[model samples]
Target chain A: MNNTLKKNDMKTAYIMLLPIVGLLTVFVVIPLLYAIFVSFYQWSFYQDSIFVGFSNYLLVLKDQAFYKAMWTGIKFALIVIPIQFVAAFLFAHLIKNLTAKVGGFVKTSIYIPHVISGVVASIVFMFIYNYNGGLANYIVSLFGSEPIPFLADVKYALGSISLPAIWLGFGFTTLIILAGINDIPDSYYEAAEIDGANTFHKMIFITLPLLKNVFLYVIVVGLTGAIQQFDLAYVMTNGGPLNSTMTPNLFIYTHFKNDPYMGYTISAALLLFVIIGVISALMFRLINSKQVED
Target chain B: MKKPKFLAFMLTVLFIISSILTGCSGTGPAGTEEEKPDDSSDSGKTVLNFWTPQWGDADKEWWEKNIEAYNKSQDKVEVKLEIVPGDAWDQKVVAAQAAGTSPDITTMNYNKIIFSAEQGKILPLDEYTDPAIWDDLYENIAEFVTLDGKHYAYPMLAEPSAVLFYRKDMFKEAGLDPEKAPVTWDELIEYGKKLKKGNVFGLAAAGNAAEYGWTHWGFQAMVGQQPISEDWSEATIVNEPTKELITFWNEMYQSGILPKQPLGGYTDIKPLAEGQVAMQINGSWAIGQLRNDYPDLLDNIGVAVVPTNDGNQDKPTASLGGWTLTIDGNSKHPKESAEFIQWLLAGDEQIMVDFFKDVTKFSKFTARKSVDEVLAQDSEGANDPWRKLIAEEVVPYAVAEPIYAWEVSMAYATALERVMLEGTDLEKSLQTAEKEINDYIKNNNYAGTNPKK
Candidate 1:
């Protein structure tokens, strides 16, 4: 009877899993495989496909634009992840202690940017970063400096593109971190306080250590999200002044439009996929390996 | 670990996320704002899925109203309309074709449609369209869509790539001739210097790569139109006249009369309309924008052809660009699409005339000579001085936009951008552009693939 019950439970679980697994196979697995197949051939939007083997992959790996875009994406993630981490942590901690009414109001206000579409946020940032006759330039002028070409110049393009992304993503990260903080038991903090711990000491010892899994989730998600940014950067810079702001997704997207570049573009996309996968794995390994070190 | 605290944290997190998600709904300027295409044909009539690039508000409304009217007028075919955002239109169309869900009919530029024609992805309209319809179109505009004696698309209208729009007040203030716009590259610089003042730029043109990429075709026409060779064999952008043209622009760029950073794109006349700059090199459509938005400033605005390479006014400083109707290769109802194209653009002169009117007072020139004749007699057509000026002085001298791949144009644009903005070597920039184009050509085996053949 126990064996039969176990078998029934197994059958039920498998039935429950079928829909999602079927969906994953259909939507994700098939497309990925198809993309891989297309990457191996000199396929085009309108022309006949010519089997080119792995020449496309080899060519994309050597292409300077591919490297430039990858580096830009990495740089973008690096800039966004650290700043988002610190800001979200700080805001979450501060907001966690406030009275319910005030905390709710602040939380809601902080989260507004998360709801704003990337397109709208990018547009808003574009106005703010306008080279002349803009709010940023106005502030600079007050300091007696020339108006900085925020979106226009290569020097400031990447950072300028990152600002909107940071603003848009800031609220979600803060909220998630706050939830993680809230999940910690008050008893730990109480015991730390009894052991001569102040708020700062308790926070340092009790909060950060316990929130390791949350930190991993946020970092891995945020890094990958920032690296794949397309709409925000495309809206603000269209990968220009120079391509200083071209993320991996934008680079792949631009290549996909130009005809006869289908094979080459797909190869680049797969390379980007690999890059993202590797980054995610490295993040998981780095974070999980920490284990609070007892 | 406490459920109560976890619940409280979740509430806070959810509230916070509400504000953070403000970036979710809006689309980028060039990003997808897709309206659902018709999935299945209605009742019994044939369904034609028609896609049009994003147009001005008035034009968009006109398209919607007309397509609805067209559908209502006929029971044999039903036209379903989808307006694709201009920036994403090309990629979406190509991708749709690749996926075998291509639209039955769509708006295409004559230059761009040629490549699709060569690929056997576009149907030759001549097979289904009457020859009389072809004869009604202006010879110059019609010639672009007709390749190897086959008409691939139907011409709607054409506009010059660049027209010199200046503030007459600025010219008067600077003691320059407001009546006679600059006719030569040298004169442009001289006039620009006189107009320069504190907090105001002397001139504004396409200052960045993408805008310059589009506007450069006109500039290429100014020198001579061999940006590539006649036989499509090699890049000819480094020739002497073109070299001189780039240097002249670079010299003007370096002369400090123009703003270091442009206030807007090449097609935007907002800088001129708002009085941010004294002179703007914008398309002829600026007349409509100025007429519609800044009428008070219209009297102060002067419209002129962009300066020729030499002092000759007959030389084109701009290229003609306009949309045409094309039937998809995979279209199930080619004959119906051809009939629809004919009924809308070619059959009725008044319909095309109304289209010109809806687009704001003939800011765009008509492609059909019959439509042109009708407009030439109407109040806003021949009577509108700006229209008259553009039609006679600008349109006559303009060359058709080149039909090469956008990548070739972008390479040249980037090269010119690096040279003009960063003061890089002209020789190096040209060499880089040439190499990039050659590589693209060689990889694609581009020889004898010309649609004109």
Candidate 2:
């Protein structure tokens, strides 16, 4: 009787898993496989596709725009990752230092930006970065600096776009990191205090080492998000000011519009996926190994 | 425990049943009326799907009103209107086409009309549409909707063609003739210099990557002759006329008459309307927007043709851009679709006039000459004689962006931007653009105006 009940439970479990498995197979797994398959073909809308046998990949590899766009992505990641990590870590530390009620209020306040829609966030940032009467310029003028066309100038456009990414994403990062910081046992800091360590020393020697796993999680997730950044660029600039803000994702989108070289776009996308995947896996492994060593 | 398990099972079954019932109930009312084959008379009405980009609030309300009017006008056919938002419209249409579930008729960009027609996604209206209907469209505007001498779509409203809008107050402040617009490139620069005050710029053209930017509306004015070879097989940007065009615009920028910052995007005439710039080159649609949104500035604003280079004074400098209503080739109900298009765009003069005056608030420039005539006679239009002037004068001179590829146009735009913004060598940048465009044409095997032997 117990065996039969166990069998029924297993059957129910499988049935519950069925919807999720089916969804993955349809939306994620199938589309990914198709993208990989199309990467090998010379495809266009309503036109006969030819088996190009990795020619599209070769072309994407050789394309100057592809390299420039990837470099832009990398540059954007570099700007976003360090700044976001530091800011989030600092804010999380500050929140952890506060009383529960005050901490909760401050956390919610910081997270308000994260809850705002990406498009709305981008528009808000656009106004802030506007040359004519933007908040950024208005503040800059108060400091006796000349007005800057943040989005229009190529020198500043990429950096201008990055501001919103940091603003929108740092709140969530802070929340996660704050939770991690809180999870650190009070005894570790208590031990450090008893050992004659100062507050800074505790933060460096005790708090920092304990937060490795959290940092690893933040960096990997943040790195991936930054690499795949699309919405902010699309809504804010449309990869303009002469494509200075054109990340690989925007480049892929532009290719899709052209239609004739869709295979080329798919190839570029696959290449970006592989590049990001390899980097992320290596980072994850390296972080895991460090944790193991500790 | 047994009782709890039994209750859960009962709840699960009830949930499933309720869900199915709710699903049925959701569509039940409409299904009975519309999906019912039992009512043969109702089934006889051919429902044709029509999709258009949701322009905005005013346009959406107008579209819904007109759609209802069209539906009530005929019992034999029912037009179901879907106002897809602009950003999502392209993706939706593409997906629909791929799935063979596209609307019977849809509005398309002028560039996409040729590309879609080439792909056989859009139907050739020449077969179903009257030849006279095509003949009545503004000739230059009609050329844009035609691919390989075949009409793929009907030309819709063109926006404010790249006409120079000047602030008469700003002109007066500069001690210049408030009524006179800059007639030539030199005169424009001269006026721009005088117009510049502490915060106000003398002139502003499209400086960004948007539709009004240097490459599009700006480049049209610069194309002294056409920018492509007569065959569309070659880039004419490498030539002397094109060289002179880029050089002049660059000089204007260098002269400090133009703004340091790029204009925000399309519909960014704020600088001109706010008196930050004395002159701005924008589309004819700005008149209506000015009248509605900036009524205070309407009296201060005057419209004129975008100043051309001395050699091309007779040639209109504005680029014609607008939507085109095309029938899906795969549509099951083609005749009904064509009939609806004919009624709204071509045949029904009253409806077309309402579409402009009431629906679009005279913001959208009409493609049909007859509708143009009627709207020009209407109260709103009669007060603004520039409507007729733009219809008769500016539109004829406006050329459509070359239909070869988007990249080709971007190449020209990039060259101008590099020279103007980044201070790249104008000649070298254009030479590179020419090579790139010609290569794209060759690689893609594009058929534009094929050169005559």
Candidate 3:
């Protein structure tokens, strides 16, 4: 009678899984398989795509612009991830200690930037960074320093492009980290305080270790988002000032939109996807394994 | 309990029905008709879709007035103008064509018309149009729209090559004569050096790679190098004159006369409008933008022909940039569409109203010589010196960018960008461009197939 009940439960479980599986097959699996298939051809909207084995991959590997873009993306991710993580954690911790009303106001104020569209943020940044009339230049002028070409110069282009992303993204990251911080039991902090632990000690032991899962989640997701960054870069630099700020996603888009090499673009996209997937998996594995020990 | 459950179910059904009714009714007000009237019922009445990227407020007002006039005069065809945004319009039209549901007619950039023709998306209107009409176009304007001995579009406007727009006040402050602005590459450098100082650039030569800075304004204006050969077999001009042009611009870069390299502020005409940049090499299209956005700059601004090489005393070559109207091959009403296009391009008062006053300023010369004459007569001594320069000097020297296969042209633009932005070895960049283009042609079986020749 128990065996019969188990079989019935298995049938019900399979039935319940059907909708999700169907959705996954339709949206994700089919498109992914189609993209892989299309990657072998020289595609254009105007003409038939001719199959050309691994040529697309070879071209992408050899392309100097692609190399530059990849390096830029890596630098962007490295700079933004740690800065964002620390800033978000600090802000969230600060908010956690604040009075409820004041904390709410501060949170809402920070989160406002997160709600602004990428295009809007980029345009606003453009004004703030404009060479002569911009606010940044005005501030610098007050300090007796010469006006800087923030977007125009190659040296500053990457940092300028990344600024808007950091501004827009950090707020949301802070909110997520705040949610995780709130989940921590108050008793842990109280116990640490009673033991004569300092604030830093409390943060290092009570806050960091307890919020490990959320930290892992934020870092992994943030890195992935940085890798696929497009809209802000597209709107602002347009992969310009000598393509110093170009990313792989921008490279793929240029291929798809400007050059009609959709096949090669898809191949590049798939390569980026694999890189992101592997990194995310490795990160999740490391974090979960560490959790197992804890 | 049973009665309550039944009542709950009844309420749920009522909610769904009301939601559905709301959705259906939301598509329109309660009583408006859903379908357009049949065109066949009225013999002389035709409905045409005219698509353009210049659907700005002024453009729309002009279109409505001219379309109204056309509808009133002929009683033949009623034209509806749909303004697609510039950035996505080309892609949108391409998708529409691929799906075989394109609008009756649309305007396309002259550089892009060849690609559309090559794809068989646009009809070659040679057989349908009167040969006499071809004579009305400026010599190169018609040539641009012609592919394989067939005209694919009705030429609308022609943006002549680059001209020098300078701040008269800045010129005065720099102790340089506004009327004696640089007329040669050497003189431009000299003048630029003299004018360079705080919060000002001597010139704003496009350094934005994506804008084809080197190819359009830099090389074309410097030594009159065309982007591709007439036969479209190879890129012919990336040699000495091109190298010289790049080197000249590099000199300007080193001089700190041009805006700091990898040019920003190309889109912000306000800097120039506010007298921050003394001189900028740009198209006539900027004239309207300046007039609209910086009215104060008008009194202090001067326009002149692009400077020539020291020895090439001939007219400086202007890059022709403008749109051409074409009927989509997939158009449901090809005959009517072609007729509408012809009417729009007609040498009548309607063309003047539609092309000049209603639309912004003529970014370029109107395609029709008659229209050009009318514009010149209308604006004779109108205090706009830039208009005078465009009318008398810029229009006559205008040359269109070479037409290659779409992919090849795109590669050329990319190569130009690399040369200007990265300071990449010009020869190496050109070689890479040539190889990529040839490979594309070979792979696509486009070799020896100059569709636009």
Candidate 4:
């Protein structure tokens, strides 16, 4: 009787898992595989696709635009990761310092941007960055600086694109880091105070060491999220001022439009994917080794 | 334990049922209607799907009114209209085509008509459409949409892609003739300096990448040269005409006549109407927008052809950029869709006239000459209120927009931009464009593939 009951329980669990597994196979797994398959073919919309083995890959490798797009992604990531981490850390500390009611209000308000759609955020920022009458120029003029066309110029464009995205994403990271901060025992800080440790010393000795896994999570997740950012960049600038801010996704998108071939775009996308994947895997390993060390 | 098992079993069944119901509910009322039998008349109507891009207020209203009128006017066919927003237009249309759920009919830009024809995305109208309807189109309009001697799209409206719009009040303030527009490129810069005041910019041309690239084609027309050869074989930007064109625009920018950064894109007349700029080079559609949104400023606005190097009114100063209605190649009701396009775009002269009336502009507007006659007699165009002046002066001179790959056009635009904004050397900038175009042509094996040829 006991054995029969266990079998029934296992059956129910498997049934619950079925939908998710099916969804993964259909949406995620199939597209990835197909993208790989199409990366070997050369043709556009309705034209007979020629099976050009490895040529598409070689072409994408040699393509200047592909390299430029990848470099832009890397540059964007470099700007985003450090700023996102620092802002989240400071914000989490500030929230921790505040009273519960005030903290809740502040936290929710900061998170309102995150809850809003990326496209909406981008549109709002477009107005804010407008050269003539935008809030950014308005404030800059007050400091006796010439008004800048923030999104419209290459020099300021990538940096301008990063600001709104960072503002949108940092709230979630702040909340996560805050939770990690809360998990640390108050007794540790109390003991540190008793042991002739100053506030900075306690932070260094107690807080930093304890939030190791959380910090790692933030960096890896933030790095990956920053690089894959499409909606905001695509919406804000449409990868313009002469494709200076063209993300890898937007590059692939424009290429597909010009010539709607599955092969070249897929090849470029796959190569980008491999590049991003390797970095992610390396980061994952770092996280695991850190976990082991901890 | 047996009771627990029973509850779990019920839960799984409930979940599956809910999922199915959710999927069904997503389609709402429109789903069932769309799934109706194709062209069989089993339901007493052949359901034809028509997709249009998101247009301006009046443009959207025109569709809403006409599609309803067409559907109600006939019981044999029902046309469903979907307005795809401008930004998402490309992606949505492509996906629909790929999925074989493409609309029976849709609107397309003239530039992509050839590419669309080559890909078999659009069907040839020569077979399904009336020959009289083909004869109704102007020679240029007919020639523009033809690929290998077959029409793929039927034009809806043709707007001269560049027209000089100026502020009469500002012109007076600068002690220039309030009625006269700059006729020569040199005169334009001269007037621009006088027009520049403390806060107002002298001119506003396209500074953004997308708008600048397209608007530059009109400048190419003004220069009396198509930047790419008609054969699509080589770059033509290194010549004297293009040299004069780029140099004039660059000098205008470097001299602080035009804004360092444009206040708005060329399609948008907001900056000109708001008095941010004394003059702006925009399309004929600006007249409609100006009349609709800034009625107070309409009286102060002056219209003229885009100025050229020698101010020769005979040369083409503008390229025709317009939309065309087309049938999907895979459409089950190609004949029906063609009939609908004919009925709307070419059928009743009054209905087509109403389109120009709704926008408040009709200067050589319609591809159909019959509609032009009706518009001249019946509808008062945008603001100019003059008939046949644009038709005579601008329309005849305005050449058909080039059908070369967009990469070539945008490459030349890049050259002009680098020279203007970054102050790159003229020869170097042209060299860059030539290299880019040559590379694209070589890679695509694009020699002599000009369908327009």
Candidate 5:
């Protein structure tokens, strides 16, 4: 009788899973496979795409501008990720420790930027960074320093642009970290306190270790988001002041959006996709393995 | 119980499938009788989709008024003007075209019109328009819209390239005469030096490559010296004159008369409008903005022709910047669109021109020669300096940029950006660009291929 019930349960489970599996196959798997297929062809909007094998890959590899854009993307992600993570983590930690009402207010304030549209944020940033009479320059003047050309200089353009991205991202990331911290039990901290662990020690040994999963999650997600950055760069710089801020995504978009060179853009996009996939997979493995050992 | 659950799920799936099949099988709104209006000739009933790039608030208001007037004037077509913001306009238009769901009439820049026409996306108006209509437009303006002996668009307006605009009040405050505007390159440099101060800049030239940078200002200013050969073949004209312009601009950058290293010109227009700049070399459109947005600065502001190498230069050659309205080839209402275009272009629609004119307050030269006198009469006023400039100086000296296939021109512009911003070796950059462009042309089979293919 027990064996018969078990068999019946197994059959019901498989039936329930069938529709979901079919949907994934139709939507995600098929489109991804088709994109991969198209990436190998020499695509043009006006004519038939010819089979080009790995020539598109070769072309992208040989292109100097593409490499420059890739490097820029890496630098942008590197700069923005750490700043965003630490700031967000601290804010979240502070909010978690605050009175409920105060914490809610702080959370609301920080999350406002996350809600603002990227284009709107970029325009506002432009005004603040304007060369003359801009808020940034006005503040610089108070310090008796010369105004910096935030958007126009190659030296400062990338950093200046990353400011808005970081500002826009910090709020959401803080909320995520705050949620993760709140999920930790009070009993662990109480035990540490009873054992005479100092506040700093409790945080370092217990809080940080317990929040590792959340930190890893933020890092990986943040890196992927930064790598695919487009709207901020397009709105603020359009890859200007010597293309100092040009990212691979912007390059792909410009080609596809302005002139429809579908084949080249698709190839570039596929390359980026592969890079993102490999990096993300490696990150996931490293984080998961560390978690397992811990 | 399990069977009933399965049956319910299957029924839901069947319903969804049947709905999708029905959706696919059903005739589109375009083909269905239900799509047609019950009263086709009903007053204030027809819907016309009009697309334009975002202009500032004043310009938007003006356009709204003009469109409203047109709708009011016509009993049939009620035009709906949709203003796409600058950042998304290009992408939106491209997507619309790809989806085969573009608006009936849309505005496109001269460079884009050629490419779109070549792709057979836009209708050629030559068949729909009378040849006599062509004779009325400024000769160069007419030539710009014509490709392969076909008219692809109606000339909307032509904005002359950069000219020196100065603050008369600021000049006086700086103890310089306003009437004697800078006439020679050397004089301009000196004037800029004189105007430089703790807060104010002498001249504002767009330095950011993203905003078309110094190329639009410096390159076009040197147009008289470097005319593209009658046949648009090579950059043979990038000779001594081009080099001189580059050297002069670089020297200006170094002189401390202009803004410091990593100069800000492109994205920030407020600096000039707010009187932070004593002088600015900008497009004719700036005049309209100064009039509308900076009404307080009216008495202080003055316009002047750009300085040349010597007084011998006949007139300032400004870069021709404008848009042309074209009907989509795939449009369902070509007849209506063509008629609407004709009505828009008629001399009586000077109000429309006035409304659509940029900050510079310059209207496009009318295609009909008969309207020239009327345009002059309409524009005659002390308050309307931009109108005068457009009618007199800009219309004559304006020249169109060389047209290439879409990809080639974009590649060329990209190359130009690199050369200007990175200070790349000009000859090498041009060589590489020329090679890349030619290769693209050959691959794409763009028009004006050299050596007879």
Candidate 6:
């Protein structure tokens, strides 16, 4: 009778899982497999596709544009991730110490950007960065300096574009980190304080060590988000000014539209996926190992 | 009691699931019926999906009104207009095509006509379209959508190539002829120098290669010639004319005659209107924008054809930028779609007038020569100086950018960016563009403008 009940429970669990499993199979698994399959062929939706047997991969590996885009993506992530980490941690800690009503106001204000669409945020930033009669140039004029081409100059375009991403990201990251901080038991901080720990010492000894998992989550997620950046580059610079702001995703998207480059586009996408996967794995391992050592 | 309660709960869950499963409330492509009110054909009207690149709210309302009119005009067909956002339209259409769910009729850029046709994405409308209608369309504009003596798409509006719009007041102040715009490239530079003063630029030449008008139309004026071979098989980026074009742009930048930042998109005429720029080159769309937003500046604005390098004032130099309505080859209702296209673009003169004058407020020019005549006779356009100038000087000279693989123009845009932004040598940049374009053409085996067998 117990075995029959166990079987029945198993059946119910499987039934419960069916809808999500089916959705994943249809949306994720099928598309991924199809992309992998298409990567091996010279495909254009308009024209007949031919089996090219990994030539697309070979082409992507050799293409200079591919490397340039990948490096830009990597540089973007490197700049964004650390900024997000420090800002989120500091803001969350400060907010956690505030009075409840004030904290709520601060949290909501900080979280507002998270809800703004990337395209909308980028457009707002575009006005700020405009070369002719932009807010940035107006400020520079006050200092008696010539106007800086924020979107036009290759040197400054990437950073100018990054501002929007950072604005949108830090808020969300802070909220997550804040939640993680709140989940930590008050007893640990109390004990640290009793042991003659000051606020900074209590944060360092009690809060930081305990928020390891959250840190891992934020950093890994932030890195991936930065790497897949598209909307900002699409709206603002359009991977222009000598392709300084071209991310891998932008490269993939541009090529994807060109039709004849379908094979190359898919191959590049898969390669980016693999690269992201490897980097994320390394990050996870490093973070987990650090936690163990602590 | 617990068993009974559990049984009741399960029965309720089953009832809800059954209702969801067996209910015919929501059916047939989740968004099809709702997002489009007149989508399904249950009312005995054949529904045709029409997709357009999204425009301003005003344009959207105008389109909906027209679609409704078309629907009500006859019970035989219901044309549903879906306005897709401009930046995302191409991707959305291509994805829909791949998924076998493309709209019956769609709007495409004039440059995309040849490539899309070659891809079999658009149907050749020669059979469905009336010859007289094609004849009525502006001849120069017609050249864009027609390939090998066959028209692939219906030309909707003609945004004539770059016209040198200058502040008449600024010109008068600078002792330059406000009546005659620059007659040559050198004259424009000279004029720019005269106009440049403290906190004001002579010209709003975009230094950064961003918009099509910034590079393509500017090159068209500078080269005073076509940069592509007649066959469209080779890019002439390394040719003398192209080099001269690049040199002119670089010199403009070096002289500080142009704005420090790239003027960006075609609609970027704010500098000119704000009096920061004395001269700017843009499409006729600016005529309406300035009239609406800056009525004070409207009287001061002077529109003239972009001058050529050789001082050939009469040479056809305007680069035509516009949209075309093409019937999707995958469409099941080709007849109905063609009828709708005809009604909107060709059949009704009143509708055409409404689109160009009433709706867009003369923001866009009609592609139809017949409609141009009607507009000229009408009060709204009769005394309009910009209208008269565009109809006579601009529309006649407008040339379509070489409609090769979409990548060719993009490669040119990139080359222009390198030359303008990075201060790269013109020769090297053009050579890079040439090599990249040739490689793309050969590698893709695109039959770009080859003689028909």
Q: TM-score chain B for all models.
A: 0.88, 0.82, 0.80, 0.88, 0.78, 0.84
Cα error of candidate 3 at position A31, Å: 4.2
Model 6's TM-score against the true structure: 0.85
What tens digits encode model 6's per-residue C-alpha lDDT throughout B1-453? 444665566556654654454343422212122232344678888899889987666678878988898888888998877898877887897677655577889988887787677767788887876778899876777877777898888888877657778999999999988897887889888988999887788887444444642347545544654444556677766777767776776777768788766555656678898888899987777776776678877778888877778777566666667888998866777778887888888987888887788666676788888888888889868887777777777666666665556566666777776877788888888889888777766655643554322
Question: A155-268, model 4: which lDDT tens digit per residue?
Answer: 888999999888888899899899999999999999988888999998898898889789878887787777777887888877877778888988888777665455677788
What DockQ does candidate 5 score?
Answer: 0.30
**Clash pairs for candidate 6:** none
Candidate with best lDDT: 1
lDDT of 2 by residue, A162-245 (tens): 988999889999999988888989999898889999989998898888888888888988998898889888888788777888
Index of the highest-TM-score prediction:
4
Against the true structure, what is every candidate's RMSD? 7.9, 6.6, 7.5, 5.4, 5.5, 6.1
Whichever of 4 and 5 has more DockQ, that candidate is 5
Q: What overall lDDT goes with each candidate model? A: 0.81, 0.75, 0.71, 0.80, 0.69, 0.77
Candidate 2, chain A: TM-score against the reference: 0.90
Worst 10 residues of 3 chain B by lDDT: B27-36
**Docking level of model 5:** acceptable
Docking level of model 3: incorrect
CA displacement after TM-score superposition, residue B306 of candidate 4 (Å): 0.9
- The docking quality of candidate 1, as DockQ, is 0.18
Q: Which runs of model 5 end up more than 4 angstroms from their true locations?
A: A1-61, A95-101, A186-205, A289-294, B1-48, B56-80, B213-239, B260-269, B347-364, B378-386, B405-453
Give the TM-score of chain A, superposed on the true chain A, for all candidates in the order listed: 0.95, 0.90, 0.90, 0.90, 0.90, 0.93
Enumerate the candidates' DockQ scores in order.
Answer: 0.18, 0.26, 0.19, 0.26, 0.30, 0.33
Which lDDT value does model 6 have at A129?
Answer: 81
Question: Stretches of candidate 3 above 4 Å error?
Answer: A1-62, A189-206, A289-294, B1-48, B69-78, B94-101, B213-218, B221-238, B261-268, B293-296, B311-313, B347-349, B376-385, B405-449
Ranking by lDDT: 1, 4, 6, 2, 3, 5
Mind giving the per-residue lDDT tens digits that candidate 5 earns over B165-233?
888988898789977788888888898888988878888866555444323533544544432322344
